[model samples]
Target: MSEEKNESTKDTKNKDKSSDSKKPSRRRSVGIVLLGVLLAAILIPLGVFVVAYATYDVPEPEEVTSKQVSSIYASDAETELARIVPPEGNRRQVELEEVPEHVQNAVLAAEDREFWTNIGFSVTGFGRAVVGQLTGDGSAGGGSTITQQYVKNSLVGDDYSYVRKARELVYSVKMTNEWSKEDILAAYLNTVYLGRNAYGIEAASHAYFDKPVSELTVEEGALLAAIIQLPSQLDPWNDPVGAETRWNYVLDGMVEMGELSAEEREGMVFPETRDPAEYSAYTEATGTNGMIKNNVIAELGEVGITEEDMTTRGLQITTTIDTKTQEATLDSVEAELAGLQEDARAAVVSIEPGTGAVRSYFGGDDATGWDYANAGLQTGSTFKIFGLAAALQQGIPLSAMYDSSPVSLPGDIVVNNWDNSDSGYTTIAEALKRSYNTSFIRLQDDLYNTTQDTADMAHALGVARSLPGVPATLTENGGQPYEGIILGQYQSRAIDMSTALATVANGGVWHETHFVERVETSDGEVLYEHEVGEGERRVSELVAANLLSAMEPIAGYSSSALAEGRTSAAKTGTAQLGDTGQNKDAWMIGATPQLSTAVWVGTADNTSAIFNEWGGNMFGSNAPSAIWKSTLDGALEGQEVLEFDSPGQINFGSAPNQLYYDPVPAYTPPAYTTPAEAEPTEEEASEPEPVEEEPAPAPEVVVPEVPTPDEPEGGGIEIAPGLVIPDFLTG
Candidate 1:
C-alpha cells in the first residue's frame, strides 16, 4: 500500500513540471507579437518622412546678374537729367573681405546667434516653431538659420507655407553641402534690403551713412544690421525712434555674443543718418522726373512694355521736357522765392499750345520725389474764365451788363468784390478784367442757373483731372453746386491750368497733355513714339477770340507779368485759406500763341500768409506773376511771337430795364427837434423850431418796381443806352 502511494505523488509532481515549462513558451510567443507591433508603429512614419524628403527637389542657386539702369533725357533726347533703376534689386555687391569684421559679427548676432555652430537645421528652433504653431502662439520663435534664410530668400522665395518651409529645409541642407559657409554669407549680405531703395550692405552703408561698407563703424554696422528685419519701418528718414530702438537692440546683442563688451557699448551712441533726399543718385533728379517717369511708363504700357520691362530691360526714355526751359523755370522760381519764408513753395508748368507737349515744369524747391505741378490747390479767381466762356458760348456778348455789387445767393452766401467796393452797372469785359465776384455770379445765374455750362467749359478746356483733397464728382453742372463756383471755389492742378490756357491759345482746340515723346529699348528699338492726334474743338473760335480780347488787358495791368514785345493774355487768382482770412494760394495763368505757362505760389504746409512784406499783396500779380513772366521770357526767348486775331463784331441788342435800386424810405422824424419849453427861450437854440404838426403825413411808402416772375430783380444792374458810367463811379 505504501509503494503505491509514493508512485502516485511522483506522477503528480512530473505533471506539474510539464505545465510550468509550457507556460514559458506561450509567454515568449506573446512577447514576439508585441515587439512586432512596436516596430511597425515606429517605422511607418519614418518611411513616410523619408519618402517626402526624397521628393523635395532642391533648386540650384541662380547666378546674380548686374541690374540694368534706364536713362532719362529731355525733349532733345540728348540732355540727361537722371537715371532710373528698380527700387528692389538696386544692390552694389562687395567681396566678403571688403565688409568690416564688425559688420559681419553684428549681423550674425542680431539675426542668427548659431550661424557658425549650428547645422543647416536647428532642432530646437524647429521644435519651438512646431509647438508654437500648435499652440497658436505666433511670437514663439523663428526656425530659420542664416543658411536657411539665404536659401529661402534666394532660391525658393519667402513664402510662408508648410510646403515652402519643407522645401526651405531641404534646400538649405543641400546648399550647405554644395557651397562653403563663407560663400553663403557673402550672397546673403549682398541680397538683403536695407532702406531708401538700397539693397545689400554696401548700398545700405552708402545710403544711410554716406560711406562705404569698409568705413562703417561698429554703431553704424549695428544699425544697418537691425534694418534687415524691417527695412521700410526702420528707415531713419521715416522712423527715427524705431530705428534707434532696433539699433540699440543689435548693439546689446553683440555684447551678449562677446563680439562687443558691455564697457565698449557704454560709450557708443546711435549714429546720425544722412538725409534721404541728399543722396547723390537722387539729388540729381528734379521733381518733374516722377511725373515724367509715370507718363513714360504709361506710354510704354500702351506699347505692351510694362514698368517691369523698362526697369529690367534697360530702356531709354525721351521726354518732351526742354532742358533749357526746365532749368529756367526752376531757377526763376527759386530766385523769386529765395528771401521769402522757408515754407514758401512754387510750381510752374509750360506747355506748347499747338501740340499739348509739356515743355518744362518745376514742381517745387525740392523736386526729386513729389510732383507739385500735378497736385491741386484752390483755383480762386482764375476759374472765373470758365464762367465767362460759358456766357460767351450762350451768345451773351462781352458787352452784357451786370451789377458788380454785394449780392446774396440761395444758401445765405453773400458775394462781394475783393475790396468790398460795388460797381452798380458794368460790362462783362470790365467785370472780368476786375474779377468782380458778384459780376461773374450774376452772369452765371442769368446764363445758366446751374453750374453745368461753366463746368462743361472748364472740363472741355482741360480741367478734367480730379485732385487729391477735392471730391472726384465735383463739377459745375453735376453733383451739388457750390455757391462759390463762379468765383473759383474748386481745386485744380497747375498743369490743368496750363492745359486750359493752352487750349484757349490754340483757337479753342483741346488736346490731352502729355510729357513722354518717345521711348526706346537698350538696343535702340523704338518701343513707343507719340503720334499727335487731331484735337477736339471745345469752343467757338469767335468766343475764344472774345475771351482772349478780354484777357489781353490783364497782362498789361501788371508790369511784372507783361511780356515785352510779345502779345499775351493772362488772369490772376487768390484764394482765402478756410476761415483764416489769409491768402493761402496765389496763381497766375497766361499764354502767348507760342507757349502757355501757369505759376502757383503757396506755403508747403498750406498755411501762412502768401502776401507778406517780402511778397507783395497784389494777389497773383506779385511773386507768381513775376515768376511766370521770367520763365516765359526764358522759355520763348528765340521762339516766334504770334498775334491773337481780332474778334468779329457781334450785335448786342438794347439793354434791359431790369435794374437793382435802393429801396425808398418812409420818413418818421425831422433832422432836428426843439423842446417846446426852449422854443421861446430860443437864445440857446440855433436851429428852426419844429412844428407840432400831425406826424408829417406818413411819407408815401414808395414801393420799388417789382419785375415779373420771368425777370428776377435785385441781383444785377440794368444798362441803358447813352449811359456813360465813369470808372470812379463803378466798383
Candidate 2:
C-alpha cells in the first residue's frame, strides 16, 4: 500500500511536471502561430505592392522623349546638306542593325558577360557592388550589368539617390520581364554615344573609318566599343591617344574574356582618316538645276535649313539631282568656260522630261560668293522654241511656205533674216532650221493680232514668268524694236529654261522643277512626296515631235556647225542688248535623250561688243556655238550611243515657197601628172569665165523627191550610221 501510494505521488508529481511543460509549450505554440500569421499578413501585402508598382506603366519622364535635330552623325553622309535622327534618352531605342558583330562582341566582353543568363540585375554582381561601395575600394569596379545600366537610364533621373536606385531596380525587373534581351541591346546601340558627334555605333564607324559598321574590323570594333563608357573622353576621332589607351583596355578585357587571341590583337591596326574634308567645309555644294551652291544655300536658308544645321547637325538630304548627269553637265560647262575669256561667266540647267526632276546644273564661277546662275537673263534665241511651237500649234505643216523677205510692222519696225538676207520665200522647215527671223515674225503677226498673242505663246511655254509686271504700254511685240520678240527678247531663269526644254523632251509636258524629291522626318515620317508633274501635259504630242525634228538638225544631221558628230540637238543665241550693262547674252540649249543642259555666257555689264565678237562678218554663229559644241563634246564622253526618236513621221503637206538646187562642186585635188605634168590651158585655168552675178534667183517652187526621215538627223545630215561615207561626204 505504501509503495503504491509513493508510486501514485510520483505519478502525480510527474503529471504536474508534464502539465507545467504542456502549459509553456501551448503558450509557445500560440506565440509561434501569431507570429506566423503576422509574418504572412506583412509579407503578402508587401509582395503585392511590389508587383503592382513594378507592373505599373509609369509615364516616361519628359527627358525620355525630348529630341531635337542633333549632330547625330559626324561624317558627311549626304553631300548637299546634313541630316538628323532620333535619340535614346531613357531606355535604349531600336537602332539601325548595321553594327558589326565584332563590335557587339567587344562591347559584350567589356560591359557584361553573363548578360544573356541574368534578368535585370546579377545578384553576384550586385552583392559585389554593395561590398565595393561599403569598402570604398572599387575592387568590384561598379559591377553593373548592361540591364541594370539600361534600367537606371530608363526609369530614374541620373541622381545617385537610393530612391533612384530602388526605382531603377523595380523598372529593370519589369523591363526584363516584358522585353527581350535583343531588344534591350538594340536600344543600347542606338542610344549610347560613341563620342565626337557619333551618337551610335554606326555613326562612329563612319566617322572613324569612313565605312559602315558592318564592315568594321576587329581592331576598329574594339576601338569604337571602348568609347561607350566615356564617349567624349575616348572618342577615336577626337582623341586618338586616349582612344588607343581605352582601346587597349578593351583589348585586354577581350583577352581576359577569351574573345580574341593575343596574336589577333597584335595584328590589329588603327584605321587612318581618309578624308578630313568629309568633316570639314571643303566639300563642293554645286547646284542641281544650273543653280550654284551659293544660290542653293541662300534658298535653303530662306526655307529654314540654317548654316549650323548644314555644317554640324549631320542632316541627310537626298536631292533631286542625278549624280551622273550633274557631274557631266558641270564638266561640260567647265570645259566650255575654260575656252571663254576669263572675265566671262556661264551657267547651265537641266531637268528630266516627264519627272521635271533636275538632272544637272552649272551655276558659273561668278557664283563665288552667291549663286548667280539661277538669276534671270534674256531668253535670247532659245526662246524661239516657243515661237516654233506656236507656228506648229496652228496646224502649220513643216512644208508650209513663209515669206522670209523683210517685213515692216505696225510701228514701221522692219525685220529680216539674221543677216538681213531674204530667204526667198522659205518653207517653215527651212526657216526653223535656219532660225530665220522674218519668217517667225510673219507667223507671229498671223497668231497675235494684239499684244496678248505673244503673251499667250509665252504662257504656253512657261516663259510668261519673265513677262511679269509688264504694262500694256509694253508692246507684247517683245521689245522696243518689236523684232526682239522674234529675236528672243524676253528673259528667263535657268530653272524655267530647263523646264521648257523638258517640255520638249517629255513629249510636250512642262513640269515644275523639283529639288527635294522626298523629305523624311527625323522619326521616319515622310513629310512630303513630290510628284507634282505626274499627269500634266503641256503640249500635244504632234507639236513636240515636230519641234524635236526641227531641233534634230541642229544636233544630229546639220547639228550646229559647232556640234557635229555628237548625237545632240542644240540652238545658239547671241542677244545684242541695248547697253553696256546689257551685254550680248550668248545662250545654248542642248540635249540628248539621257540629259539636257542650257549654257549661258555673259558679262554682268552686258555689251553689244560681245555680240560683234561672236557674230563677225558671218552670221550670228560664232562664240555661242563654240561654247555649245565644246560643252556637248566633252559631256558626251563615255556615254552610250543614243539617237533621238521622233514622235512620228514628220509631215509636210504642200510644196515649199521655192525649190532651190545647186550641184555640189566636185573635188579636184591638185592634178598630179608625174614631174612632167602639163599645165592647163589659159581658157581652162580661167575657171569658165566666172558666171555672171545674177544673185542666183530662188529655184522654182515645186515638190521633189525628199529623203525619208530615217536618214538619222545629225552628223551633218545623217547618211547611215554604219554606211561608209563617200569622198564627197569627207569633203
Candidate 3:
C-alpha cells in the first residue's frame, strides 16, 4: 500500500513537474507573440503615416507672377524712364515650360536624380544624409528631391536639420500627391536663387542674359542652374572661375544624364562677360552725371532709403532721372564753367515746374567723387527772385520806384553796385534788370524788415533757414551775411535751388522733388504713386511774370549780358565773402520753355576758380554762359522753340497807366558824365531834349503786361493793375 501510495505521490509530483514544464513553454510562446504584436503595431502605424503623407494630395502652390512695366512716353531722353512708369519692385514668376529643359534636367541631375520615382526621401540617400550629418560632412551632397526643396521652402523656413528634413519629406509627399509635375517644376524654378541680385530663375535669366527665361540657351541655362546650388559662391561676376567650373560640371551632368545631346553640349560656350544692364530694370548710361549721388546719400535719412538696401539687397530703382536731360545739364555746366574755375565755383539745377521732377541737374564733380553741384552754397543775385516775389506779394509792381544810391543800414553797412557806383533813381524792374546791390538792400530793409517778408518769401520758395545762422559748410565767403539781398548770400542745395526755380516755371506751384517715380512688387502691383501738391506760392502770377520779365535782359540782347540767341531768362551772380577777400561764388540761373537750370562753378576748397586764373569777366556769362548755350542748343535740337507765357494777370488791353514814381529832374548833371567825357563834351552841351520830332513812334516797350489784381487770387495779394510804387531800390 505504501509503495502504491508513494508511486501515486511520485506520479502526482511528476504531473506537477510536467505541468510546470508546459507552463514555461506556454509563457515563452505568449511572450514571443506579444513581442511580435508590439513590433507589428509600431510598424503598421508608421507605415500608414508614411504612406498617407506620401500619397496624400496637396494643393499646388500659387503661380508666381509679376507686375508689368508701363511704357514711358516722352521725347526727352532724360525723361524716358519717367514716361514709362515701372510697377515698383517686381517679383517674377516662371512657368515650367518657360524654363529650358536643360535647366530642369540639370537641377534634377545635380540635386536629385531619383526625383520622379522616390517617395520624397530615398532610402539610400537618407542613409548617406545620416552619415553625412554624423560626420559633419554635408559635402557628400543632399538626397532631398526638388519637390522636397520646394516643400521645405514653402512649409519650413531655412532650418536644415534631421527633424526639419523629416517634415520636409512628409510635405514633399503631400506636395507630389497634390501638385502636378509641372507645378512642382514651376515652384522649384520660382524659388531658386540666381545671382546678380536675382531671386529666381526668371529674374536671373533676365539679369544674366538680358532675355526671358524661355529664351535661355543650353549654356546659359546650365550656368543659371549651377547658380541655384550656391548663388553667392558660384556667382559669375564675383566668382567667375568657380562659376565656370560649376557650369561645366552642370553641362557634364546634363550630358551624362542624356538630357543634352552630345552636339548641343559640345556647342555650349560659357559667357565671358556679364553686362549689368542685362538685369537692371533701369537703363544705364555710360556717360551718367553722378553729381547727385552724394546729395542723395547725404539726405538718404530724409528720403527713407537705407544704405544697406543700396549695397546688399538687390534694389530696382526707378529714379526720376532723365539720362539725356541729365547729360545736357552736365554738358551745359561743364561748358559754362570751362577755363574760369579759378575765379569761382558754379552749380546748376533744373526741375519740372509742376511735378518737381529733376529733369536736368548738373553738379560739378568727376565720375568718382562727391557732386558739388547739389552742395548748399551762397546764392548771389538769385535771391532777388524770391525777394522781388516777397515785395510783389504785397501789391508792389515793376513800375515801383526806389532810390538807387548807396544806403547805410543800422549796422552802418553801406552797399553799392558791382561798379561801386549807383544811379540816383530807378524802377522796380530797372533795379532787377541792373542787378543793383544797394537797391536790393534798401528794399529788403523796407519790405522784409517790416513784415518778415524776406523770411516769408524764402520759406515760400523752399529755402530752409541756415542752422543757427550757420550756412552750408561749402558756401561762398564761408557763409557770411551780405548787404546785397538782391545778390544771393544764403546757402542751399542745387536741387532745392532747381525746385525753387521750377516754382516760377510752374506758375508758383511747388512740387516736392523726387528721384523715384513708383514702387511695385516684382509682380505688377502698384505699391505707390507720387502726386503733385501745390506748395506756398512765393508770388502771384503777376509777381512771377514781373520777375520773369525782369530776367529777360540777361540774354545777349542786353548791353550788360553774354548769352546769345537762346530765348532765355536768366540771372548771374558773383559773391565774395564779407569781411574777407577769400572765397568767391559765381552762378548762372537760367531757363527756357523746355528746361530750367542753375550753374555754379567754384572749387571744393572755395579757393580755386574755373580756369585757375582771373580777369574782369567772372560772372555766369563767361564760362557758365557758354556751357549753358551750347548744351541748350544741342538738347533742344528737334523741339519747338517756345517762351514762358506772361502771367494771366497782365491786361495789355487797358488804358496806359501813369509812371509809378516822380520823374528825375530834366537837367544833365555835371558829375554824372561818362568816362569818355570826364570833362563836358561840346556836343553834349549843345544837345537838348530836341523838340519831339513828330511823335517819335512810341518806343516799343519790351516788358510784358503785369497781371491785374482781380485774377483768381492764387498767392496772398489783391491790388489793381495801375502802376504801383517801386520799393526795391528806395528805403
All-Cα superposition RMSD per candidate: 17.0, 18.2, 14.9
- For 667-716, candidate 3 gives per-residue lDDT tens digits of 11011112121221323211111222222212221222432111000000
Give the alpha carbon lDDT tens digit for every residue of 168-196 in model 2: 66666676777777776765665556655
Reference-based lDDT, each prediction: 0.69, 0.53, 0.54
Q: What is the lDDT of residue 337 in candidate 3?
A: 47
Runs off by more than 4 Å, candidate 2: 1-97, 121-171, 236-241, 266-323, 341-344, 354-357, 364-374, 397-439, 448-453, 461-486, 509-537, 555-568, 576-578, 581-584, 592-594, 603-731
TM-scores for candidates 1 onward, in order? 0.56, 0.62, 0.67
| Count of clashes in candidate 3 | 65
- Deviation from native of the Cα of residue 192 in model 1, angstroms: 18
Determine the backbone clash count of candidate 1: 5
Order of models, best lDDT first: 1, 3, 2
lDDT per residue as tens, model 1, 1-731: 89999999999999999999999999999999999888887797557556765765654433433344567789888887656666556555677888998999999987888777776778899888988989999898978888887777666788778878877787777667666778778878877778777777887888889888999999989999989888989987788999999989889899889999899999998898998777754333555565555555555565587766666555678888898788789788878788677667787889898888888877754433345576656667788888888777777788888998777654333555665568799998888777777788788887644476666677777875344333342353347445455556556678888998998898888766777788776545787888779776777777778889888878667555444588888888776543333466778899998889999887664434565334343257767888998888888888777799898654453222111111221111111112132111112211111222221211222222542111001111111121111000111
CA error at residue 127 for candidate 2, angstroms: 7.8
Reference-based lDDT, residue 47, model 2:
88
Clashing pairs in model 1?
Answer: 286-367, 287-367, 423-731, 451-476, 452-477
Cα deviation of 697 in candidate 3 (Å)? 49
